[model samples]
Target: MHPRLKAVSFAVATLLAGAASAQSATHIAVTDAPDAQSATADAPASTALSRVTVQGARVRELPISSGALGARTDLETPFSTRQVTAEDLDARQVKSLGKIFANDASVMSLGDTFSFNAYSINVRGIPLDDYNGYKINGLPFFMTTVELPVESFESVQLLKGSSGFMYGFGAPGGIINFVTKKPTDKTLFSADLGYRSDGVFSEHIDAGGRVGDDRRFGYRLNLTHEQGDTYNGANVQRNSGSLGLDARLTSALTWTADAIYQSRRVKGGVQDFFLDDFNGDTLPKAPSGRKNLGAAYDNTFFNSNVFFVSSGLRWQIDPNWSAKVDVSRSQDRRRYSGQWMGLLNGAGDYTVYLNKAQGAATYEQAQALVEGEFTAAGLRHQVTLGLAWQGLNKQTVPKSLYTPIGQENLYAPITPLSWNGSYDDSLQYHNYHSAQKAVFASDTVQFSEQWSALLGLRYSDYDQTSFNTAGTVTNQYHKTPVTPTVALMFRARPDTLLYASYVESLEQGSTVGQTYVNKDEVLAPLKSRQYEIGAKHEGRDWGATAALFEIDRGAEYANAQNVYVSNGQIRLRGAELNGYWNLPAGLRLTGSAAWTAGKYRETDAELVGHRLEGIPKWQGSIGASQKIPGVEGLSANAELHYYARFDADSANKYKLPGYSTVNLGVSYETQIAAHPVTLRAGVDNVFNRNYWGFLQSGYTFVGAPRTLGVNAKIEL
Candidate 1:
């Protein structure tokens, strides 16, 4: 065996032995019971007791439900899963979804977030944007071309691996599930006010309650508005609202619905430059991070209006069998206007253009599942059979003409151009349609109290078609694929699980970028695979997990003829360690580390062995939080994030320098005029370190500067 693999194996064995000896007093049951496999809200006492730590007690026992796995705790599952709860988000005053991964080493931000419209991320070394990469309550929710209302979600859950069998035709970067905040059984109301360093201000209101004597109907509503100068020197304004409702028609049936509206507009467009237009073997020198190079008259805007509705029917067929059916529909509409520029000469001359576009997509999904438990030949088995269908249709109108707006000098800038919103063929349209129908089944077999195995398979038929501006069919694709998953888990002790899994994913093939000659062309479906092994420990006061994984996926590159093709392969192998611990003196420590190697294994362009773009080989973070020794309602926390140097292009000729940043925060909880109030203040990028952020897609942007934020929440 390779030395690295040998070392990981030895460590796993040692940990298993140590856990067994240390926790022999307790026992855990690994039974193939129908109820045990069903998603539930009940949790062990030990798990509940652990939510008493320093940073608002991030819960460890939250049940996660996605794909065919149903609802289960992270420790009992055979995959790498992490979650950030509402309490954690509030305690840290998390600004956006991109910032949520600062403490998670396995995920990386790949684009500037000065505006929600440009945010993108990479999970386990696979890049994914809002589109084709996010879900709300296990159903498709726009994240690609539309912005999600983060305030409406109760928690953010990340499943890191190839989830094709669970979510058909998705990117191989893993799945991001947003669990909406459900209606409360009791009346609740809250309000919050906040301020940012750059003169930004915000307000939010949230309310939920049950109606009627029996409390069968529940409702929740949220509203928020924020506007100000952002850390990146962009003027941003955002407004959002959401409503959730659920009604119990009978003992076995429930109906739920959601309506959300969000819009973001930037008066001064943020910094985003492309390297393709520059003529140099190495990347050009970046201008001042604080300089505003955008034309004074240019602005970027993004707006989204989404409506979603779902219903569920649960029936108990027999003593050991149950069935469920779920159906949902979502429609999202978006509008965008923006531009990106690139320096063309040493004199600080650059090229800039303005464009406007509009898009709308509708997603419909349905699922049916049946689960049963039985014993045969002295072994226990839990079986699940499911069928699912998804349909998505989209229409878009893009700007047909690019009129260059002269750029200004870097050292001294002046407005060089203005626009009156006139364009050629601005209403030209394109239509797209995609559909997937799948049938899947899984069985978990328990041979003894300590051993269990899961086997699953999914068969799917996918269809896609596109229409040009003239309403003529331009492209069509159809494919039927089968994906399989297998895993085995062993309970080393009552609190420890050692597991290994193999999973495969299927995704839409490469789509040539706008910069390529055949920009609108699409390829066939691509198949990717992942192999992983890991260990998880869930204790009364602490939790930890470690894993080693490798992923191989299809990639695209420009050949010697300058034609883009999908005849390329990318591979990523890495190890991750993440966990949190609480000390006796009310201090809590959390840490995460990842080391990855990404390579272009094969390519038509002489790029074999070159490092993949925008992927840092080493990334990690560490945090500490503690309650003040003498202050009953005060706590202080700090964290540091680090990234290793990485390449910005496939050729590996240009690279980005490594950088690190630190953040500090403090919070106090007390009563204000008899109402419970919490005050929080924090500083991000404390040193105002200037560095290049993401460099994927041949575009580079500067990181955020040091910024201060203060917030206060009052319970009513």
Candidate 2:
């Protein structure tokens, strides 16, 4: 990845202002190889010019100032930021949120079929349990109830570290903020309608407009609908949308409000069974060597409802200073009513899987943030403050509908995948809980137009009091934590920057602080800390960056009921390199590679010196798009990703082999009927190789099998 001496010399000369700028030099860098940009551009044949981003920020000729203490939303930006631009998103033809997750290295999704195409994202192999709240448009509000429509977003931004200073009480690993596309001054609108390899169809809309003279006010709306079958036949369908309005409240004081709504009725399939549940519990007993129940296994189904509202306002406050505030409210509701034949019959205690779960769960949260920034003598500074509150409600009732007999019939036999029992709707259980409130703040300071530093802190106090529908307290717990972050950056050159940062994060145990019997003692909070250092160089034609990081996470154990504190501590150390290069003659390329080592410090982790459970030791990807020099309307793209082998459990008990997959795409677009149109087609897993990103049941969910997509669009 090192540049040749000539490339570096040209770069230095440009900085020294001693060289005749290279053609397209405004958009590219001399140090980048001619074809480097192809690695990042989408549809190499794209006739439109390309824009490359280093970290999360755009590699523009002019720098835009913000009130944020550095880049608050991108972990890669500070030193290890990663970005997936709108163009790449479109060319990849991603439809679900899980697919979009590929934009980053630290993320891996369980896919669309598990929770009715719902998702469980593993960041650095750590599950997201809402310790660090998710945000929308820089607000602590969450989209509690729905799937994301790719066409509705300008892009998704991920901020790693202690961001609580701005959003309040979140996981230390980092924060992910979904930046919805804002309405622009254009009166015309656009739409995309297509179907994927799976038996699913989708339609999305994007519309916006300017409000008055000078067009200071603007509004945008995004809507999406998709319904289809998974590789497994589980039914899937979702509807989600976003509406935003930005008013130039005097140019110096603007008000922006955006709302997001989503609803899904997805049927779940029997997901992976916990290793402990299979061994110790001895319930839901499957014969040994069983990796998965198989594609032929009947699926369990569940339905859920989700919704949220987010809004923000910006005030010039004064020419030298500006202030902004944002708020978001969200609700999540789930209804699990399914019949898993052997699930409830768990050879001995199948009740765990309970072929029948007539239960309902709902959780809601609210958060707000206020920020101010200033500019003086080439120096810029930004400060942000925030608060968060969250609550959870639950209810359960035994159903006789699936049980053949009445009351006692709740134990009736279940049809592996069908609900053929009677409904009782008699026996019932319910518990309600809530999270602690947190307040936080942080300062980001930039000096001499080249150096920047950020510091932030947050305090949280949580009180959980759960009760039975009978109005009796069933559990009570409390805890509090204080977290902080510090980061420093040195701009080696206008186009290059280097930085280092340290951050702390905490997560409340969902079942940790419960007031159970002597066997169910209260659980302690989980903690994590991260350190990272790296550098970046971005320009129009080429952009690249490299970084090293280490993260330490505290204990996760099972309760005294003889539990192992499922939350053991873990440590991760590694480095990643990624970037894009676009050169003359229509050649472009971009890619990333990483080597990681992780392990557990506690727990009877059988694999003492082994990598952390289920985490990969090495993983990386590279992609390229190219124009055939003289091919006016033709372009091609190729991408390859590799994941190294690693264990699946804490004991270093089982190993999941490493695998690699490749994707290729091509397209052609031009004026047809004077109405411009674009045509695209791509195949994932091009070789149609059968592989698994991780072990599932007896069979790993097949990596998206050789898949295909064709899209066409007309701009008005």
- Top-lDDT structure, candidate number: 1
Model 2 lowest lDDT segment of ten: 29-38
Clashes of each: 4, 57
Q: Which parts of model 2 have CA positions greater than 4 angstroms off?
A: 1-79, 113-117, 131-133, 141-146, 161-166, 212-217, 267-270, 273-299, 337-382, 385-430, 445-452, 510-523, 557-568, 605-610, 693-702
Candidate 2 lDDT over 123-218, as tens digits, reads 555655543445555544333224554565555555444443444455555565565666664474666666656566777666777778788767
TM-score of 1: 0.90
lDDT of candidate 1 at residue 262, scale 0 to 100? 72
* Candidate 2, position 402, lDDT: 30
**TM agreement with the true structure for every prediction:** 0.90, 0.77
- Please give the lDDT score for candidate 2: 0.52
- The residue ranges of model 1 lying beyond 4 angstroms of the native Cα positions read 1-8, 11-60, 129-131, 284-289, 314-322, 345-349, 409-411, 419-421, 424-428
